[model samples]
Target: MKHVLLALDESDDRAVAQAETVRDLFDTEHTTAHLLHDFTDNFEGASVGQIAAVRHAANILEDAGIAVEYHETSGSPSTSIIEAADELDVDAITIAGRERSKAGKVLFGSVSQEVILGTDRPVLVCSRRTEE
Candidate 1:
């Protein structure tokens, strides 16, 4: 079975995009998704299942017949995600990218970018669908 680590933030739209990407790119019947959510200070003590984004993504994947497991950690998002991927030994890591200005990215840094650079495993970056 193929294993994928889906790192989700709080955005429901982004969660949908990530879940859809996983469902589309892998064989749902044989794919197992490890849903991960990093609870920062703002979300301190929150459970992975308590997050809407995680619920949304879980529903999407489960509906697609993909097996799913929930994981939660509190720390740096990028670091936590990378560590989870390593510990889980997933086939790939999927994360949703948010629109940000170059200046913003330079100033605040990007979790997706950090995950892309920090891990040796394949990373799939998904962007939320924009309304036309």
Candidate 2:
């Protein structure tokens, strides 16, 4: 049995939609859906990593018949996400993929890229146009 973490953020329509999508992508029985959110003291107050957001996303995963363990962590988004994956020793990680704008890419760098390059585990990046 392997654990699969469904990384979530404040993105739109994640509730049932994203959870079900992940459930179908990975086996729920042999897998545990781990949801992690990071809340940091950014200039805009506490953000996606907040415990409340993680709790909200966890509820959605549960509704989809996926057994999930969720956590709210403090730290950089990519760093903490990788740490969570390491802690669980999951077989893989499933995260939403976004098309990075040139400017955005240059400034903040890429979270997905960072995670993908930093970890040895295979990362399944979910995108609308991506093929299973």
Candidate 3:
């Protein structure tokens, strides 16, 4: 079975939407997904919101017959995602990319871009689809 690391943000609708899109496009009955969230705060792992978000994502994958695991960490998002992918020995890393203005992107680095550049494994970046 292939293992996929699904990176998420607990509160962002765009993140959630991208994750759903990733599930729809890539998940299979035999795939195992690790739902991961990274926090900047160095507190206890897995906040309530993070757990809820993971569960939310998990439901989608589980309903599709994919096994799911929840992982949480405190650190740089891109670094944490890469670490989780390596530790879990995932076959690929999936992340949601939000639309950002060029100036915004330049001011604040993109975690997705960093992950794509930093990891040797395959990275699947799903763009946040706009609502009609």
What TM-score against the true fold does each predicted structure earn? Answer: 0.89, 0.71, 0.79
Q: Is candidate 1 or candidate 3 better by TM-score?
A: 1
Model 1 agreement with the true structure over 1-132: per-residue lDDT tens digits: 999999988999889999999999999999999999888875356788999989999999999999999998888999999999999999999987776797665532378789999999999988776789
The parts of candidate 1 lying over 4 Å away from their true place are 42-44, 101-109
Clashing pairs in 1: none
Per-residue lDDT for 9-124 in model 3, tens only?
Answer: 76456446645765786647768888888878745554624566666777777777877777778878999999999999999888876667977665334787789889999988
In Å, residue 63's CA in model 1 sits off its true spot by 0.5
Model 1: weakest 10-residue lDDT segment is 102-111
- Candidate 2 matches the true fold with a TM-score of 0.71
Residue pairs with colliding backbones in model 2 are 37-49, 38-49, 39-49
RMSD of each: 2.5, 4.7, 2.9
Q: Which stretches of candidate 3 lie over 4 Å from their true place?
A: 42-50, 102-109
7-104, model 2: which lDDT tens digit per residue? 77766444334565666776656667878776665555654435454566566666666678766577788888799999999888767665568776
Which structure among the candidates has the greatest TM-score? Answer: 1
Clashes of each: 0, 3, 0
Give residue 55's error in model 1 in angstroms: 0.4
Off by over 4 Å in 2: 14-18, 42-60, 99-109, 129-132
